[model samples]
Target: MKTNFDFLMPSVNFFGPGVIEKIGDRAKMLNMKKPLIVTDAFLEKVENGPVAQTLTSLEAAGVDYVVFNGVEPNPKVRNIQAAKKLYLESGCDSIITVGGGSAHDTGKGTGIILTNGDDITTLAGIETLENPLPPLMAVNTTAGTGSELTRHCVITNEETHLKFVVVSWRNIPLVSFNDPLLMLDVPAKLTAATGMDAFVQAIEPYVSTNRNPITDGQCLQAIKLIEGSLREAVANGHNVEARTAMVEAEMLAGMAFNNADLGYVHAMAHQLGGQYDAPHGVCCALLLPVVEEFNIISDPERFKELAVAMGENVDGLSTRDAAELAIKAMRQMADDVGIPRSIKAIGAKPEDFELMAENALKDGNAFSNPRKATKAQIVELFQKAYDAE
Candidate 1:
C-alpha cells in the first residue's frame, strides 16, 4: 500500500558558502522599501557579525531598514507584541530575520498579527490563519532547525505554558538564507545541539505516518549528511566545507519535516522547551533516541535503515540488532556533542512528566508518529528521559 504526501518550501532560497551578501537586491526586486529586521540582541551588538554585514550590504545597495532585536528563544506573545509595535513605529513594510528557527518564527508571527490584527493567541494550532502575512526574509545562523525555509512558526503561550505552532503557507519567508559563513563563530555546544536537531527532524519524518517516498528520500539523505558532517562542524567551527555541508543537510531536513510533519520526538521536546524554557535543540537531543528506541519494535526493518543512515554498519546484523545499534549510535553522537543526557539534569521535574505527556498528545506533530502512543506510553517515555542521567 502507498500513501500520498505533499512537499513545500519558501518561494525563493539562497544556500551556499556566502549567500547572505545576495539579499540586498533580492529584497529590492520585491519592492521592499522598509524592511523590519527581527532577531535577538546577542548577534545585533557584534558589528562584525552576519546581521551587521546584512545591514551594511543593504546600506550599500540603498535598501531601507530598521532593526528590532528583541526576539527571544521560545519566542513569547510579549516578544511578538513588542516587535509589532516597533514594526508599526518604524514604518517598515517587509521583514528580514537573521538567526535560527526562533528568529525566523518570531518574524513570521509578528508579521501575521500586525498585518491582520492583535491577539496572537487566536492564530495558534494549524492552518487557522485567514489572511496572508507580509513579505519576509530569513537568514539562518545555525545548521539546524531550517525554519528559514519552512512555513511553521513555533511560539510559546506564556499564559498557559504550552508551545503554539502557527502554520500557514503565508508565513513562509520570501527568501530563505543559508550562509555557512554566519556559522563560523557559533559555539561547539550549540553546533552539536542544532546538528542533532536536524538529525531528529530527518529521522522523525522518514518514519512518520504521513511520510511518502519523496519525503522519505529527502530525510534519508539529510540523515546521512548530519551523521557524516556534524562532528567535524562541531570540532572545528572554522571548517568552511563542513559548515556548508551541514547547512545543505539542515535545509533538506527542514523541507522534509515541515511538510511531512514531525512525530513524537518533536511533540515531547516542544512541551519540555515550552514548560521549562529550555533550549529547543537540547531538548530534542535528549528525547529523540528514547522515542525511536520505543518505536523500533513496530518496524525493525525501517529502524535498520535509520541505523545505516546514522553511519552504522548493518551488513551482518539482524534487523533487530541493527535497530539497537542505531539507538546506540544516536546516544553516542549526542554525548560527543556535549548534549546532556537527562532532562532532570537540565531542571525538568519528574512529577511534571505526566502533564508534559498529556500536552504532547495534543501536539499537531505527534499525530503523525510511526507508532501510536497511549498517554501512559508517552508518560513512560518521559520517565526514561527523566532517568537518563
Candidate 2:
C-alpha cells in the first residue's frame, strides 16, 4: 500500500434502464467513426440481445461497426489476436464491447496489443502498457465482473492453461453503460453466479490490505445492496427493482476492487477458470467462503462489519462470533442463489491443486489478500473448497 494513491474510473458512465440508448451518441462524442464490436456468439445470435441493441443504437447514430463474436466464456490469448486482426482489417478506429467480462476483456486486450505491441502476453503485469488505448466503450449487459469500468483484464493462455491479468489505468474504458433492462433476461444460474461474484468483489476489497476509506465505503454499500437484492434478482430476473439494485451493487463493487485490488478468491478462481474452463463467477462463489475463512484471523473486526453489511443479525456477539456469522451468511446466500458448494462440482482435481496453488500465489491479485498465504495454505484452501459440502 502506498501513502499516496489515485482513484480511477471511466470519464463517462451512464446507469439506468434505457441508458444503453445513448451508446451511439456517446460513441459519436468520442469521434468513433467505425468501431469493432467485440462480443460472444450467444449475444450475436440472440435476435434482440445486447449486441443487437447496440447495433441498433450505433446504426441510429450513423456509426458503422464490424462484429467479432468469437469470444469464449474465458477469453483466450488467441481471442485478443483475432479481435485485433479484425479491428485492423475492418478499418476500425474504435472498439465497442458488448456483454460481460469476456467480451470487455477481449476488447481491452485487443486495444493494448494494437498500440503497445502485437503480442499481449508480454503486457500481463501491472502498468506495462506504454501507450493509451484507442477509443473504447463498454456497454455492459451483465452486472457482474465490472470489467466495463475497471482497469483490469483477464486473458487465458491456451498452451499453458493459465489465466493472466492485465492491470493498467489505460485499460479503463472511455465510457461505460449499466442498463438494468439489458439484464432482465439473464438465465437464473448465470444471474446467481454473477451476483455472488459481485458479493466476493465487495467482501474481498473491504478486507484487502490495500483498502482505503473510499473503497471501504463503496465495498460496504455494495455488500448491503447485494444482500438486499441478489436473491430476488436470481429468483425472478424480471424483477426490475432487484435487477437495478444488482446493477448498482455490481458497479460499486467493481469500482471498489478496481482501486483496493482483490484477494485470494480471485487469484485461486483464475486458476480454476484456466484449468477446467469453468465459469469464472462459479469458481469465485465456491472459493470465496473457504478463502475468507482463512482470512478471518487477519481482520475479525472487518469480518464483523461484513456480517452486518450482509444483513446477518450479529447483535451483542463477540467479534469472532460475529465474523463466523459472516461466513455462514455467505454459505446461506450462495445456497439460496443455487451456487454449487464445491470446486469438485466444477471438475477441479486434487492432483492439480499444487500447481494451481503455485500459480495463484503468482497472480497479481494475490498480493493484496488480507492474509499472506503460503503455497501449502493455498493448496489446503483448494482442497477445502473442493471437499466443501
Candidate 3:
C-alpha cells in the first residue's frame, strides 16, 4: 500500500500475429544501423525461430547486422563474453534477441559488457551496470520468461554455478514482441513448464512484500489467464486462441513480477537452475507447492486469492483449509503437466540439499517472501523436495 511506487517494461510492445514485421522499423528508431541478432544454435535451425524474419526485416531496412547463435539454455557468463566479442568485431551497434529468455539475457549481458568495456563480472548485481547498454529489442519465441519486457537477466557464472540477477532499468528492451504465432511450434512439455512459470510469477507476487494495487491487478489477471489457458495450450498446441491467452498470461505475469518482485519459489528455483541445471519452470513447479504449503502458516488469508486464481473453489473451508486446498490444486496441476514431484526424481542428490538450501536462503528474491525463512527452514524445505512425492 505504498503511495509511491515504480514500474518497468518495454517502452513499446507489439502483441498479436504479424507484429514482428515492425522489428526493423523499431531498430531504425533506436538509431541502430548495425544490429547483432542473438539466439541459440538449436533455435536458429527451428522453423519458428525469429532468426530468418529478423534477418529479412533488417536487410530490407538496410540495417547491417551479424548473427551470433551459440547461446544455450541456462546460459553462462562465457556466452555473454563470446557474444560481446562478436558484437565488437562486427561493429554491431544494437542487439535483437529472437528466442526465449536465454537469447534475451545473452543480448542484455553482452550489451552491458559491449558498452562498459569488459570484465563482464563487474556488472554482477543490481544496478552495478552504470553505463547505458546499447538499445535492445526482444522478440520472444516462448510465452514465458517474460524477459522480453522485464529488466532482469539471470546469467550463470560458468565456474561458480551462481545465478546472478542483473537488475537494471537499462535491461528492459526498447520493444517486445508477443505474437502467439511464434509459439505455435513449441513442444507440449516446454509449453507446460513455461506456462507454469508464468503462473508462479503471478501467485508469488500476490504475497510479496512489495505488492501494490497495480501489480495486484496484473498478477491476479495473469493467474486467471494461465489457469484457464495453460492446459489448453499444452493439450492442443495448435489452438491459436489458447496460445493467445497463454501469451497474455505470460505478458501480464512479467508486468506483475517485474515491479513487485517474486517470492521463495523463484529464490529456490534459481539455485536449482544454477546448481543442477534444472529447467527453470520445472524447478519452479516442484518448488511452488512445497513453498506454498510451508508459507501458508504465515499468511493463510492470502491463499484465498491464490486458490481462486488457481481455479479452486473455496466454498466453506477455513482460511487454513483453503490454503491447503490451493496447495493440492497446484500439485495436481504439476502432475497433470508431467512435472516430477521431487528433486530426487529429477536427478538431484539428497546430499546436495543442504548447500542448495544455503544458497536459496541468500537469493535476493527470498527477502520479499511473506513467510521469512531461516537457513534451517530452507534445509527442511529442501529435504521435502528431495524425497519424490
Candidate 4:
C-alpha cells in the first residue's frame, strides 16, 4: 500500500432519484446566474428528455441560460470551439452540462478554453492548464463514463482521427447530479455499452500500477455492484433500482480510476473510438478482456482478487487459474450485455491495427498499464481484440 495518494471528486454530488430537480438551486448556490448548457442535439430534441428537465429546473430557479446542443459522441475539438463561441457570445457566467460523457467533456473543454484562452488541443495532456477553469456543473444521464466526478476529458482530433486525453484537477465539475430516473430512457444497446465501460473502469484500476488501498476498495465495491446490477440495468432499462445501482457503481469506478488512472484497455479503446467514431463503452468492452489477459501475467494475484470481486468462484484455484477466471467473468458479463464479440464487427479494420497500436502507445493512460507493451506487442493485442470471440 502506498503511504501517500491523492483522492478527488466533485465538491458537491447530488445522487439518487429526484436529485436533478435541484439543479436550479444548486446553480444558484454556485452563484451561476447565467450559464451555458452544453448537450447533444438528440437530448435537446427528445420529448421530455433529460435536457428538458434540466431547463425546467433552471427556469424555476429564475436562472438565465443559453443552450449549445452541438456536442457529438467522441466529441471533437470543433465541438468545444463552437461551444466556447456560444459561451462568449451569451456572456454566460458558468457552464452546465447535461447527458453523458460527450456533453460533460464538451463542457469541460469549453470551460478550459474559456479561462485559459488557448486552442483546446493545446491543453490535451495532464496538468497543462495554466489557470483554473470556470465553474462547471455536470448532470449525468448515463451510468457510465463518470465524467461528472472525474477530472479527465477526452476529445478527438478530427484531422488526425486520434483522441487526446486531458487530466487536470481543475477540470473536475463544481457540482454533479446523478439521477437514475434520467437514465430510464436510454436504449438497451447504449445501456449495455455504458455499463461495460463502467465495468472496465473498475477492473482496470484494480490492476493498475498506481493502485492504492483506497482505490482498491472503491474498485472492488464497484465490481461487486456492477456484477450484481449491470445485466439487470441493460436487460430492463426501466428498472429504477438496477439503474440506481449501476449509477452508484459507475460513480465508484470513476472515483477509482480518477485517482489511480486507467490502463491499456482505455488507452487502446481511445484509438478505436477516435478512428471509427465508435461508442467508447463498446470499444472498451471489446478490448478489456484482451488487455487484461495480456496484463494478468504482470499481476496474477491482483487479477485473482478481481475475479473474487466480480463474483467468480475461484476457491482452491491457483493464482493463474483464478486470474484466468477474471477474464472469463469479464467476457461473460460483456456477452450477457450483448457487446459485439469483436472489434471487427464494430468497423475496425485489420490494416489499421498498426497505426492504432502506435497511437495507443502514446496515450497517457498507457503509462499506468501493469505491463509495459512494445509497439509490436500492442499491435498483437489489437489483433487479438479484433479476433476475440
Q: Write the per-residue lDDT of candidate 1 for residues 1-389, one digit (tens) a residue.
A: 12755668887889887688888988888888999999889999976798898898788779999999998988998898998999899889889999998899889989888866798777767777888888898989999998998888898999888997877878888888898999989999889989999989888888887777888889989988887889999999999988988998999899988888888999999999999998899999999889999988878998899888888889989889998998999899899888889988668887888999999998888888888999999999999998896
Q: Give, for candidate 3, the lowest lDDT window spanning 10 residues.
A: 117-126
The root-mean-square deviation over C-alpha atoms between each candidate and the true structure, in angstroms, is 1.3, 1.0, 1.4, 0.9
Candidate 2 residues 278-384, lDDT tens each?
99999999998899999999989999999998888998999999999999999999999999898989998999999999999999999999899899999999999
| After superposition, candidate 3 runs with Cα above 4 Å error | none
- Model 2, runs deviating above 4 Å: 1-3
lDDT by residue (tens digit), candidate 4, 1-389 = 45588889998999999998999998988999899999998999988789999999999999999999999999999999999888888899899999999999999999888888767777777888889888899999999999999999899999999999989999999999999999998999999989999999999888888889999999999999999998998888999999999999999999999999999999999999999999999999999989999998998999999999888899999999999999999999999999987999879998999999999988989999999999999999999987876
Between prediction 2 and prediction 3, the one with superior lDDT is 2
Q: Which stretches of candidate 4 lie over 4 Å from their true place?
A: none
Clashing pairs in 4: none
- Sequence-dependent TM-score of model 2: 0.98
Candidate scoring better on lDDT of 3 and 4:
4
Q: TM-score for each prediction?
A: 0.97, 0.98, 0.97, 0.98
Ranking by lDDT: 2, 4, 1, 3
Residues forming the 10-long window of minimal summed lDDT in candidate 4: 116-125
Model 1 lDDT on a 0 to 1 scale: 0.88
